[model samples]
Structure formats: C-alpha cells, structure tokens
Target: MSNEQPPSEQPPPDTASDRLLADMLGLFNRYERETAAARASQGDTNPYDLAPYEDVHGVTNEYEAARDSDDPRALDQFLDNLADGFHLEDVRALRMATAAVQAAMGRIALAARERGMSPDRIAAETGYTASRITQFIREEKQRRAAGDQ
Candidate 1:
C-alpha cells in the first residue's frame, strides 16, 4: 500500500556478526585448501606435520605418541588437540579417521599378545589382519626400547 519497495525487491544483506563469522570461516577454508594442495603436491597424506603442533602447549611429544600409539584413543586425542588448538572443523573429521586406524592397530597388537595367539590369529579377531604383527610388535618394541620414557 505504501511506496516502499516490496520484500522481494530488497537486496540481500549481511549483518555485522554474519560478516565477521564469514570472514573467519573463509580464513580457515583457505588454510585447509592450501594444506590439501601441499599434501597433494607431495604425493602423500601423512598428516604428521611436527611444525604446526610445535609452540602450541608443548604438546609435541603427546602428538608424536598419539601418531605411534597404535591406540584409537591416542589418535582421537591428537585430533581433538589439533582441532581445539586451531579451531578447525575439518580437522575434527581427520582426527576421527586417524584415531580409528590407530586404535585398530593397537587392538591388532593386543590380539597378537593374547594366549598363544599368532599375529594372524590376533588380526582375525581384531579385524585388522595385518598378517605381520611381528613388524608391529618389533616397531613397538624398538620404540619402547629407545626409552620412550
């Protein structure tokens, strides 16, 4: 009834908080894209960069332990730390995936330890079937032998 433009005629708009959040999200998205490109260019997906974790709460050893723990919990904790430290949502998913694999590996090693259980036996029960539990055991041993304390 008035001369005012209809709602449909109004231009799309962004609020102050909306713009702030969008800017923040964009910054993180750019980082993820860059990191992904870096990994792809290297032909690897290791996800074990010791640089970013450095200088952040002195968690260097913790992160390394998580990587090598072969324990699911370790991987989860590692990813959580990374996400919390960097405030990135994508890393949350990466953390879950990493934790699952490591946990399965840990179970495999544990299965190999059960009574008279060969590495194969352990793998069968644990669903990993690494077929070379010896290698896992050996690596674990070496890691322990090196005074991981």
Candidate 2:
C-alpha cells in the first residue's frame, strides 16, 4: 500500500482560506457563548428565548445552525431576527453581538488592506459590495482616529 495518508488523517495545511475558516468558527463560538451569557445575565430563564421564535421547541437547533455556519450572514440574519422585537435583553444582545462581529470583520478588512488588497477584492471575498467595503474601511479609520484623540 502507498504511504500517502488519508485526508482525514492528514493535518490541514496552514493556508489563508483555512485561517479564515478557523477565524469564522472562533467568532461563531464566541457569539454563542456571549449570547448565552447575556441571556443568563438578563435573567432569562429559558435558554432558547433568544431563538427568535414564539415556539421555543427545537429552535435551539435552528439557532445553533445559524450561529455555527460557515456563512457569516447566517449569524447576521439570526441577530436581525432577534432585534426585530421589543425585548430589551434581545436588543442588547443583538447590539453586542453585532458590534463584536463587525469589529472582527473590520480588523480582517484592514489586514487585507494592509496586504494591498483593493476594496473590490476584499468585497469579493467577503460577499459585500465594493462600496460597502470602502465604507467599512472608512468607518474603521475614523474609529481609530477618534480613539487617538
């Protein structure tokens, strides 16, 4: 038999794509943990209360799917749903999660910019429009500038 190892047995190569995927998963895990903590701190008795549904049954699975996906928009959409109502805890959690995820995306975009990636390129990779990518970079720069003052 050949000495070649199977894909499952082999270690993943340290490619940019792999790094991005790892970062995504890390961010998702943080989102889940933080959201749960926020719920607990707000005295939410039900763990599935943040699931964005009236019927809490089986919604944890749907929430997990939304939070643990490779697509960042899944989490964004989930947060959107959460923020759609007038619940104070849900709004606060959504705001916190949105800020955290946006900060991470900003850092990634800035790193790409530092590496000479154009807005169009970053947008293509991030699934955002070039104009929006440019706007995000501008906003991040302003935030840093404000922090320097």
Candidate 3:
C-alpha cells in the first residue's frame, strides 16, 4: 500500500501555534512603533548639527565670531546682540517702568530726608549706604533748585 495520503485528506491546522505566532507578530509591530516614537520625541541628538545654534533670521558673522572667540566678553556681546535683535515690547516696557519706579523711590527718599529722617536712619531702613542716601537727597535738592530757576 502507498504511504502518501490523498490531497483531500489534509491534516488539521495548528490553530494554537498559529494564534501564538500572530500574537508575537503583533507585539513586535507594537514594539517597533513605540521605539520609533521614542526616537522622535528625543529630537535631534547629533552634536554636529548646527541647525539649533543658528538664529531664525540667519547665522550672523557676529554670532560666529563670538562662538569662535576665547574672550568672555564676546559671549556677553553676543547675548546683547541677540537681545537687541529680538526686541520684546513687553520686556522693554518693563525695563522702562523699572526706571520710573527707581526715580520715584529716589524722590520719596528725598522727601523722607526733608521730613527730618536722618541719612543713617534712611540707609538702615532702605538697605542703602548712608553716602548713597545723602547723594540721592543732594541730587533731589539740585533738581528742585534747577526747576525753580
């Protein structure tokens, strides 16, 4: 008798093994997707890429020179250049308001001194040097005198 079986009498499919294989494939695909997302979240990790260092407008010669220089002041100048180039109106307004507040404080100090508050007492109360307090009072008096003329 022949040992071969007829094509119509095939063995049953291994359903358990097929399900396990399908599950493994799904897990592998999920792992690949997660890995790709992690890399994307990390952004460009290459140190050789200068794209991040370049300004949005363009790479200026001043920035390049500052970056290449050994002087510490060059970095300060570079920062100043960047700040001057990108003028935030809100920051400018805040700086102006700060100046106005300082002037007002100086005037108030002068008024306090005019009300018989000693320079030493004013300095101790305001956390300023006695000489600085005296200077502020003198300046205020001079300003008043100038206005009276």
Candidate 4:
C-alpha cells in the first residue's frame, strides 16, 4: 500500500544538532574558498577569502572513525591533526582519559604495596609483564617526585 508521508507537524527544531549541521554544511561549502585563502597566504594576491566555519562534526567523525578502527597510531595521528581546531569538550575528554589511566595505575601500585606484594609479583598475578609494571610505577613515582620539587 502506498502512503504519502505527512509534512512535519511543526517547524524544525532549533537545537544544537541543527546548528552543528548548518556549520558543517557551511564549512563543506567553503572548501574552495579555504583552499584559495591558503594559496593566497603563499602569495597569490587575488585569492578568495575564507569564511573559516569550524566543522565540529568533520573532526569528530574523523576522530571516531579512526578510534573505531582500533589503531592507536591512527588515533594519535587523528588527534595530532585535530588538536588545533578541536572543541573544548574533546580536550576535556582527553584530559579525563589521561587522568583516569594514571589514577588506575596509581591504585594498582598502592594496592600492591598494601598487600605486601612485590610489584613484579603483582604484575605477574595481573598478567602485565614485570617491565611494564616497573615502567608504570616509575612514571607515577617520577611525577610525584617532580611535583614535590
């Protein structure tokens, strides 16, 4: 059976998604202008002026796609390329992840000490190689030491 789709019941919602989509479209449309401006910076006098709409979705899509591929090197490259234009929330997320990893390692070391276990033994029990455990311990120790100075 054929059914005609009803028109929207109300006007479009003016939410963040709509704003971000509009910005992405604006940025996509500005590619040629950006390229000309970049070229002009290299000394072409008559080049187009770039409107410079920051595309959050473009960066996020690239970042998520790289991260989903399970390759840290690719993710690292994506981060490096993205850092200059990334939104503040992305920076906060990165900072949070760094802190969480550091805190987890600190907890493991503290728990190992409280249990009277040699870190190497703890590492073996936990499936990390002794060298990795040592490295983690030393990193936290060094950070603490530097902070004390």
Cα-based lDDT for every prediction: 0.65, 0.76, 0.72, 0.69
TM-score between model 3 and native? 0.36
* Candidate 3 total steric clashes: 0
Better of 2 and 3 by TM-score: 3
TM-score of 2: 0.35
Residue 57 lDDT in candidate 3: 28
Candidates ranked, most accurate by TM-score first: 3, 2, 4, 1
Give the candidate number with the greatest lDDT. 2
Q: Output the better candidate (2/4) by lDDT.
A: 2
Deviation (Å) of 13 in candidate 2: 31
- Which consecutive 10 residues in model 2 have the weakest lDDT in total? 50-59
User: What TM-score does structure 1 among the candidates reach?
Assistant: 0.29
lDDT of residue 53 for candidate 1:
36
- Cα deviation of 142 in candidate 4 (Å)? 0.5
Give the root-mean-square deviation of each candidate in angstroms. Answer: 17.1, 16.9, 23.4, 16.1
Task: Give lDDT: candidate 4, residue 47.
Answer: 55
lDDT of 1 at 6: 77
Per-candidate clashes, comma-separated: 1, 0, 0, 0
Could you tell me every candidate's TM-score relative to the true structure?
A: 0.29, 0.35, 0.36, 0.29
lDDT by residue for model 4 (1-149), tens = 74644545534549989878867877986997788879878985335532112444455566669898877699887767666555787677767876886678865775675678887797876667777777777777787788999
Per-residue C-alpha lDDT of model 3 across residues 1-149, encoded as one tens digit per residue: 99877746846447999778767987998987777677667873322233323332243555667888999799788777566645467456657876896787669789898899999999987778999988888888899899999
Better of 1 and 2 by TM-score: 2
What does candidate 1's lDDT look like per residue over 1-149, in tens digits? Answer: 78877757854447988778767887998998789778868874333354443443346556768889978798898877566667455456558766986756644485457556777776665456555666676666666578766
